[model samples]
Target chain A: MKEKLTDSELIAMVNGGNQQAFSELMKRYRKMVARVVIGMLGDTPEADDVGQEVFVRFYQSISSFRGDSALGTYLTRIAINLSLNELNSRKRRFLFFSVKDDEQPLPDLADEANVDESLSRNELIEKALAHLDPKFRSVILLRLIEGYSTKETAEMLGVPLGTVLSRLTRAQDRLKEIVSKLSREMVINTADTTAKVKVKTELK
Target chain B: MKSKTFNPEKNIGNFFENYDADFKPFFETRVMARIENMVMSYQMNRDFAFRKIFMPALATLVVVFVLAVIMGQGISVQSLMGWTNIDMESAIASSMGY
Candidate 1:
């Protein structure tokens, strides 16, 4: 009967200092939170830390949680905000070290050294997404990875629907650009290596 | 169909084609461990606030009372606040057990 209790009931128990109730809430939303966190933070230890923080934050403030949205959406919102906060803090720390503070931070993805033919399609997309600006990346994460409807995505980000659409277009364009660029370079390198191998074979 | 060209970018979606991260075993247990740690830390903070902050504050209030009693000029907690003296004559007449 306790397992069958609804989200409201679970939250009430959590408010009463029930640790198991909190754990149940975590179990219910863990994967969705992980998907959003890991999609932003990558498959690193940082992602796991952020994922855990999201539930902890929700548990701490469970009393203020008036169920205006589905519990999943509420948790997802926290996950997204925390991920962006982590990013902004990283940028601030970088700014503190850099000499030219006047320059606007350009949106660049991660180190593409991980970009190679051996990577699977999923790994490639994940890697490519790392290069995208956080705004555009959120669009891809929410739209492509999490599969939220356009309206829902817009609501979550507090942006207009048109904004979400435009961001999606930009994100897809960037993704295509990065993927195509890497794919081309890899293809060319493979061709060049093959050509050298063939000439060596001829000499032999 | 005139043989569609192989554009690597076009097949980008195919990379995630049939791709999803499988659920790792004991994922819930791992998450719960983190939550439990957070809860314990929060409790410790509350405990610290009571011991480190509340106890000292209570001690200061007790010291204020002892200092006021030693001075004995009707040295109530209110006197330290620089409040205007109460009109005791008006107070006694108003409280005539009516």
Candidate 2:
């Protein structure tokens, strides 16, 4: 069965121009790729597009893949690179338009049936992540969220191990600060809503 | 009141572990479709290049080579650069005061 094929087998089939094999490969690694992309870029449409581009790039270079690294690692590398590129362009756009970072809209969560506690928490997490510098963000996502080893994260990012360690320390410190601030704002917002509701009920 | 401790590391790990990072429904189908479109476009561009650019350029090269050979000039840097009439041996000898 195609599902039982190893990465090397799938890669060989793909190199032989088997589209179905490539599709199977994509299906197999989509979650891993999605996690890296979405973690780095947030759950924006650009993340989705980058997710697709990762596989497309692999397909284009199938003939030369050589299978030195596992397919998952290779795809994660592409996702990270593409996500960083998206982040750079986002920085450029923000600077060019002189847009206040806070004015940027929250990621859409309307499709969910219940946009309650979990939704807000996720939104807070995303906001906190968005505040990180891309370099720090990448290390946090890979080392913490995706649960890759620090050395693995460094290899994937093409950075030295010491750099990853230093970045991880700094990134964690910055993330704690950002998350604390966001959590405080969330608490204030909830209290404000409760007070407004109490007043409205009393007026009625 | 018991104060709650904030641990970003544990919170981040827990949050992302439960996070559904899956793409929308039929994402694989969409990706496959895009790959097909890309492959088709690449093949089309390659074909177009072979037809419009490569073939004509190759034909021109062959024609020029044939013309050069037929005219007995051969295909050398001198002949191609319009220096076919120069007598390099005698010119070099005279320059050296032979």
Candidate 3:
């Protein structure tokens, strides 16, 4: 899908001390990196931060690459690993209990914005995506969200095509279920609120 | 063969319909900034390598050339000018057989 300088050309330019070529490589893979970050971070501000860090890391180590994998695949793997690390650290700090600060436990998820209410269609899709585990989510994002073909996704994730297919199918099914559940809840909540309001008015 | 239902394309399209061009724009600047940062790092690395390698190599060559010239002048010119001559034949014979 990408057409421009080949990996060898870019590597040569980079080794030759050509900053412009390095810039070109960044432009080439920026979207791919951003998508992978977004998949893991679920549209948070941190996705961009994490995505930027991935490229920075990639650029730092570009000289050491042995050309075993495609450059794009290499960058994506770095992005995925970094994004997962960020997510894990955030969860540990925020989601689980901390003994150090016992002054009023952190507000439950109820205090956080509702995923179903604030999310746009794309955000809803992303929110639904948050339900799947990272392995499946990586494959799904690469295949469905990023529109990479099956073979491409397999290559990117370094998994067999069969594995990609199965994981993607499962991931899609899981996302569909999550979205349906959220939509149903929204409807039920709206109906319940209306009913309660009507009953209170009649009593008054 | 219970029932095959749900079009994959339709579902795929639904996912794409969620694509946020706005979000994409927000990320573009971020990505470019990242690229710039990477480029800066690469430049720094290149600078480091040049200093670490090429500069030292040049320095070594310069030192070796100066030493070689000084040694050559001290030995070769004195011998050639015969400023401290010993018998050449004796010198050759002694050096050969000594």
lDDT (tens digit, per residue) of candidate 1 on B17-79: 443442356666776787778768989999999999999999987777777677774575575
> Candidate 3 lDDT, tens digit per residue, A1-204?
236779778878877877667667777777777667887677787887787788667767878988887787788778878977886787678865644321222222343244233335555556656766777778877777667789977876778999998987877776666656555554555566678789999999
lDDT of 2 by residue, A1-204 (tens): 544999899888878878788878888899888877877788889988999899888888888888888787888888999999988787778876755442343323332232233235555666667777788888988887777898899999999999999988887777776666555555555566688789999999
Which DockQ values do the candidates obtain, in the order shown? 0.22, 0.31, 0.13
- Report the C-alpha lDDT of model 2 over B1-98, residue by residue, as the tens digit: 00024455465455444544666678888888998898789899999999999999899888877878898998986666557465889889989999
Write down the TM-score for model 3.
Answer: 0.55
lDDT digits (tens) for residues A1-204 of candidate 1: 354889999999888878788778777788788778877766777677778778778877889999999899899899999988887876788876864422223323243443243545555555666778888888888887777899999999989999999999877877777766655555555566678789999999
lDDT of 1: 0.72
Stretches of candidate 1 exceeding 4 Å from the true structure? A1-5, A95-117, A182-204, B1-34, B48-98
Give the better candidate number (2 or 3) by DockQ. 2
lDDT of 1 at A129: 68
lDDT against the true structure, each candidate: 0.72, 0.75, 0.67
Chain A, candidate 2, TM-score of 0.79
- Regarding DockQ, does 1 or 2 come out ahead? 2
Give the clashing pairs for model 3: A122-B18
Q: What is the lDDT for A190 in model 2? A: 55
The pairs that clash in candidate 1 are: A109-A131
